[model samples]
Target chain A: MAVRTPTGSPSGRALGLGAAAALLLLVGCCTVGLSMELQGTVSLEGRLFPQASAYQGQEDYDASLVLEPELYWEGEGGLSCSLKPFLRLDTSDPERSHSDLREANLLYGADSWQLLFGLDKVFWGVTEFVHLVDIVNQTDLVESPDQEEKLGQPMLALSLEQEWGTLEAYLLPLFRERTFPGSRGRLRGPLVIDSGAAEYESGAGRTHPDLALRYSHTLGNLDLGLYQFFGTSREPLFLPSAGQEEELIPFYSQISQTGLDLQLVEGQWLWKLEALQRSGQGPGRGAVACGFEYTWVRPWQLDLDLGFIAEYVRDQRRLADDSPYDNDLMLGMRLGLNDAQGSELLLGMVQDLAQPSCFMVLEAGQRLGESLHLSLSGYLFVRTAEQDPLRFYQQDSYLLFKGSYYF
Target chain B: MKRSLMLLLLLALMPVSPLQALAETPEEQGHAIAVEADRRSSGFGDCTADTVMILRNREGQENRRQLRSRVLEQEDDGDKSLTLFDSPGDVRGTILLTFSHKRGDDDQWLFLPALKRVKRISAANKSGAFMGSEFAFEDLGSRELEKYGHRYLGSESLDGRECFVLEQIPLDSKNSGYSRIISWLDTTTYRLIREEYFDQKQRLLKTLFCREYQQYLGFLWKAHRLEMVNHQNGKETDLLFANYRFQVGLTDRDFRKNRLKNLRTGGGR
Candidate 1:
């Protein structure tokens, strides 16, 4: 479970810090009419484990403080810049703490067309259980085991808005390797992920440029999207180095992917589907996730809505599948409270229908005060088999609490 | 007998029902009244306004939000409007675009700043609360005459002003949360004065009262304050409107979905 830091040298670490400060300074100089808006969050998060780990001296409780500051400068004539940097300090383990540049983008243009440059983030797909087609940014796994956080992606994006639909083209010049949990961190796989020891299939190595094209439009009650990407696959094939000393090496392959995302709205039902076909690393295969959400508004006149969700995800590989969801069924319930505090609760469970394994998740978030927000999330694995990826964390079930304050 | 004649003479001096002048059925009279109201409110071209919404819970705890709204009046079709949130820092810069249709379902899109994307929301979920307020999205839509079926109820004096009460049933009730709505319009100006909403279960749900009428451009009338009280949940939303600017010259391009992202605060028309 040891994670090797690519920037291990002292000077390398300082260079990263210096770059973040320089981005803020550049943003400050481009402001117009004192439009530099500073916003951030200071949060303390704690995780509690139900069972102690086998490793000796491993604490059952861990705490950390995270500071995420964001700055934006919106100048005149369609020129704007933004910088958001995150810093986390772990009280128990320094290696577990990390810093990431979430965004540092400059945008130009006004109405029909626009251009964006620098590091940015873009999300795709419509499923709640898994993001099968969202591969633009590298996963910031060190922040959380859920892999919802993403690192900044260096790219240039041009978008055109039209009556038929919106078309966007992206040029990604750099590749960012995914981060992993350090040795001191909990809820990690048995084998460590060494990001430094990574290989690329392309001869050009990390300099291989990635290209993406996306078109999204809403036709009547359906929201449809189509995407094509030619780039290195974000998911790596983990392998052990061929040496006496066993070390995990990640091999990334250049691949082409075509994806479609669609959502249909009818009365109280919302049908969503995300499908993708890809090739390169393994045999050509297709994956699809389809689901529906039924919402009841103001049920029993309580100023709240209850939504039921059911989804099925499948990969063509079936039993020989390394994919998390080969033949899985996901069921969920969402509670939206129509309150001024913007309260919401979601409970979901993904069960592998072909195996005796299930993963359950509970997430609840709400606004605390004018500028503060609170969130509670829990992950539980039930009856996981040895072949299941979640089996490694059978005893790693924990609850995380976060309280953030915005400035 | 002499006192009764004197009372009758006094009642004759009061305002008479305009519908009495024309011989028509109850339904026809209701349709005519609605058509006149729609006609009187038309031809303003475009308008901009600022609004403050106060939401109060059962315990009387209050939370407020501010918004700016721009509307483009359509001659033969439903109008288009854009609402931008200005207060409650968390929701600031959020935009809601609505395109209403006369015959079919309305379309709505929400621009969420955190997601940095425009989401096409379900127009069928009209019963859902709007921005955590008691007012539903259906209540914020343009009042197109073709969208409802009307029946004239008896007239009554409200707040010392003679009013015409009518029962309006949604033509397409599948997506609507209400079974019927009772609206009171000022007989003199065709301005909506009060409304009662009945839920799909035929239960009394909410009541809305409009007051403090202001004349814009010396011809069009608008309410300065609108209060909606939900009886079932004991929640209320009070909207105070101000700075009504008519003939601001907005166009269809200004309300496009893509324009929502770069929309300057308080800038359009």
Candidate 2:
């Protein structure tokens, strides 16, 4: 199998270089008495696979190192700037060794309005299992299978705050292609993804202008957010290469999406829902993720808190959509020890409603002393259906350990 | 005998001091003391403070966290507060905004820095520990006079100061960690000096000592240091407050959930 560079997107590289230069200039021209702070973390991760890799040349174990640093500068008159850069080096998979600028933005805030420019990350969702409405940033797929890591997006945003609610408008200028694991990575599909040959429906390609508007408000115990976005869809469709049978080419389409996310807090229970309707690609479709989390504080007279989570996800597009949460039920439990170390454990399982496929996840973390944090996570895929996308990685169960030092 | 009776009637007609009026029922006396304390601290308007929290285990191992707090006093209901965490690297820039209500459950929201997400959380976890410290969420919130039922437990001398002792039972017993709290207030200033917490099983669970009292605005008394010790687990926590600023012009806008994302930690202000 042949591998391509995952972080070699020309548009992302150009924006990253520009931001780096701007960050240096901003720091150099700072006046006296301005506040500057630097903080970050360095981590080492190790993964152990229980079975042999399904793809040839893939290793049974892997090691990686990551460094993420954040720098912030604040001056007088409500002006501030922040820069955060992320870098990871993998020993087994070359494509996993990537770097990104998570945030490099300048912000100016006034009494009732604010302006922001540059690369930034924004999250907008209420459900735990799947983020149906969070599409502002591209998913950093090689970094985590859980889809929590995101690549910074280049944007200019303005926000107006009032007694009723907050309204925000965003103008996105650049699009980042989703990353894919290399052939040597364990958690990958059967065919390699040639991200370098990705195609866009818009003539402007990566420079297509995207627009988004959102309004968020809190009424008593309920929090609500409504948004509309018109842009190149972050989710891509794959097609077999013309000549290469073992490779797939990604196709990006223009899309318009309307989303709503809501959360209600009632006593010990938190009810959440995220729904979205989109038009583009082949046909119009809708998706929803709904869930509730109920907490038992100090149950059985113990010094810990236990939270029960249940979520349901449904996507009308089904197999056409690349998400595994098309029709699924997720149930989980979270335990917090409430100790000096801040120990916590979360166990969850996502069961496919249409097939005999399920995925189990376990995550546990605790702190050592003040600056060091240790965490362990395991992912297991059970009997996947023939048409299920998860079938490609049915034998790729693995456990990962990470230790981070903060400064 | 007629002259003595005339003098008694005149004495009864005159005004009585607050201390003499305490000769009424214990419940009435306790209610009056609480009302007096609330009145004395009512007009501060707003305040901001920097706090260092130190948590110790049984073996004396300690961990520290730093935070900044801003509070805006409300005239009709409970106060609104915002707490920004500055330390522990991982939790830096996290903020907790609270809108406390006197009659029902408070509204709380947590802002996660990494995700830039604001989540409305259930206030039923008021008994849960705060940041893995001995202090619970309820302990750090605004203390409304209507949240508890009180009874006078007489007077006592603590640290050579005459203090009024009162027993308070939480109005919402299901959410509170303690069955009862015995508080000691200074007689002169009506400032809280000490507290003893009893668990749901009616066993003594923790003791808190408030010290280093300082007066702000020429009238408002604030405690600069508080120490809480868990008797059952042999763990302790100390809160050291500094840089107390009163009437700092904090308004309701400052505590809004939308503003949480813009707050810079590590004393950026």
- For every prediction, compared with the true complex, DockQ reads 0.33, 0.62
Instruction: Give per-residue CA lDDT, model 1, range A1-407, as digits (tens).
Output: 34334357332354375456557556565543636767767888998878876443345668889987877777666677767787888765445677767777777865688898877778777776777778788787777666668877878999888888989899987777766655556665655556656788998666689999999888878888899999988777777765513346677889898999998877677789999998876874789999988888777756688989899998763222135687799999999997899899999999998899998999998886567778899888776877877676787788988887766
Give the lDDT of residue A295 in candidate 2.
91
lDDT of predicted model 2: 0.86
A44-70 in candidate 2: lDDT tens per residue? 999999897888878899999999998
Candidate 2 ranges with C-alpha deviation above 4 Å: A1-8, A318-321, B1-16, B19-23
lDDT tens digits, residues B1-269, model 1? 35433434543464775466552688867877787677678779999999999999899988888899999987667899999987665676689999888877777778876555676666765777887987888898887677789888979999899999999998777667799999999988989999999998899999999989989887899999999999998999999999999886677767877667656443434
The best candidate in terms of lDDT: 2
Q: What are the lDDT scores of the predictions, listed in order?
A: 0.78, 0.86
The clash number for model 2 is 0
